[model samples]
Target: MTIPTPPPGPEPLRETIARHGLDARKALGQHFLLDPGITARIAGLAGDLAGQNVVEVGPGPGGLTRALLDSEAGRVVAVEVDTRAVAIITELASRAGGRLEVIEADAMRLDLTTLCPAPRQVIANLPYNVGTPLLVGWLRQAAAWTRLTLMFQQEVAERICAAPGSAHYGRLGVLAQWTCRCGVLMHIPPGAFSPPPKVHSAVVGLIPHAHQPDAALFRAMEQVTAAAFGQRRKMLRGALKPLGGESLLAEAGIDGSRRAETLDIAEFDRLARLHMRRAAA
Candidate 1:
């Protein structure tokens, strides 16, 4: 049986915002996506959502929310911090016949793994200010998500997929590349949003790796990378001195004089393993 569409029409997003006197809050990094073509394309980048529960971070004005519903997703649990946007999303939920749920909460603090059933795909046009931190948080618990189709500034998108030798390579690159296979699917200009951001934006798809080291080992990786890249310009010996200094590099068979930017994922894992071994000793 085909699902019934929502009654004739709902007010346009512009009108919804206007009537509510809503404007993008710079503090929240809120830039409402207003273009249906771009929104549809962003939804499409997630691939088939036929049986997937999609967690949308900021469904401002319900533009992308509407697109996701139309994408035949199994369900969408939209988490919005702004109350103004909440009303719009909630109204969309009523028309969705239960497939869409508007949750009034902060995505940063929300426990998304339990928000919906397993095989959850987190798809969102993330607020710019919080985007990187949110992505890092999700990376820490990569096993909880099946896929992450997220929007971030183009520079950030580059950092996510950057190779070891590039200028963009750093802590974000190390963690993201190690935890999942990620790539930029498409670019959306600043004009696509209601209040355009200064920087260009890109949609990224992150599919987690099947074989990740356990939590203990992952924590060690984080520690090693954090110290190595904390100053970033310092050599491994100086940066990692507190962790074990040159001995740690010797144990991992890495050069003590090299900077963090040149170390590939495998080298990072080598250092992480050494860090864990010495810790267990």
Candidate 2:
């Protein structure tokens, strides 16, 4: 199908909702982002979507779908768990000129790298309930995408981009920062949705590292971070006891007295590497 050229004038999303009898379904964790301007801004942040394969998650009622198609994006493969929403987005695909493919499945279950052409990038306003789990799954396969521009509750966004020693810093911050450069792009007020969520939302982007820390080291870092931040208030010597306490810190040349939040990415990597060498031995 040829990509549908958006006709001149407004797309009339609200009118479409009224005509189609669409309402956000809480069962699906569906809160449709309703602002056209916000949609346009999100698509633009993807950085030259033209000819790039883009993946969008939870394309409820096609708000962001229309924006992505209007932009220069070459192709968009949207995965939606809600079957009802999938039907609506399929119509969006036709209007999108064959450039949009609607996949009726959970984003967490799909293999993004295998679904689209290379140079893939993910851009979406994720369903709130499944956002963090989906993100952690994607991070596990970070090499699959060139970049990702995603919208999440502001709290999750903070966790992803949090600085070391900050209150928000934890396993999430360590895992995200370990492989990618991430930052918040925009703050979306709660009022911008059909059924506005309780908390505000934000857009954040991730650009994966060109060369990651060693694979074994990276895994060990994740393990160490999980143990440390899983008990954040405890001293590192106590928190990281699962990975061998003072001996692990000593081998990594780090001070065991420090708390988890105080260690930066380099120190995390150092611990990971130390764990790796010991495992190899």
Candidate 3:
């Protein structure tokens, strides 16, 4: 017997998850977004999603998935790790008139740059556990995306857009700002999630800058930031010891006494460049 289709809109989110006996599993960081209004607004932040390819990570119960499809996005390629949600995503895809594609693959393992169509925007309420790592991967391949509208824990969101001298400014801030123009799009409370997360969440928008340095420079920044922030309490002179400490700071034209959180993206770029010089020498 052919089963009848459910009515459209946000109700399907709750119904689908309930019908499938799916609960938000903590291990997967699965806090499903049941509010379609909020999801719609998040999709809206992508700016004229119509005729644009969108990559959605972790489409639990197809809530945001439906929002993206309804926004008239040209196509949506949802990469989901949870096999349980596949059926729900497939249902959404079927309704999308061949515009939606669901890949039962881990977002972290999949390089979206090689996977999705060009002129793509990534919009998702990212699984909290893997959000930061996934974002780092994307930023490393920033050229592939037109924009990234992603959700992360409020703290992480702040860190991504934090300026130098701010308490949240550190490795993530430096790395994110190094390659993209980052901002907090909207703040979501813990209550917004089905099983409320311990902390608030925020949606962030990252548009790649015109002048991202080469891979080598990125690596250099990674190395330098890792070392500096690894021992953040210590001054640059002490923290960057393996890379010549005070001398390295001098070579970069930075003060050896400065701390990691005080350095902006430009300073980090300079430090990365200097680190590369040291490696070459």
Candidate 3's C-alpha runs over 4 A off are: 1-11
Cα lDDT of model 1 by residue, 55-134, tens digit: 99988888889899999799999999999889778878888889998899998997788899988999999999999989
RMSD of candidate 2 to the truth, in angstroms, is: 3.6
**Higher-scoring candidate on lDDT, 2 or 3:** 3
Q: Write the number of the candidate with greater lDDT, choosing between 1 and 3.
A: 1
**Number of the predicted model whose lDDT against the real structure is largest:** 1
Give TM per candidate.
0.95, 0.92, 0.95
- TM-score quality measure for candidate 3: 0.95
| lDDT of every model, 2 decimals | 0.90, 0.85, 0.88
Check candidate 2 and list the clashing pairs.
2-97, 3-97, 4-96, 4-97
Let me know the TM-score candidate 2 reaches against the reference structure.
Answer: 0.92
For residues 156-241, could you state the per-residue lDDT of candidate 2 as single tens digits?
A: 99999999878899888888988898999999999999898999999999999987665566677778888988887899999888
Where is model 2 more than 4 Å wrong at Cα? 1-11, 213-215
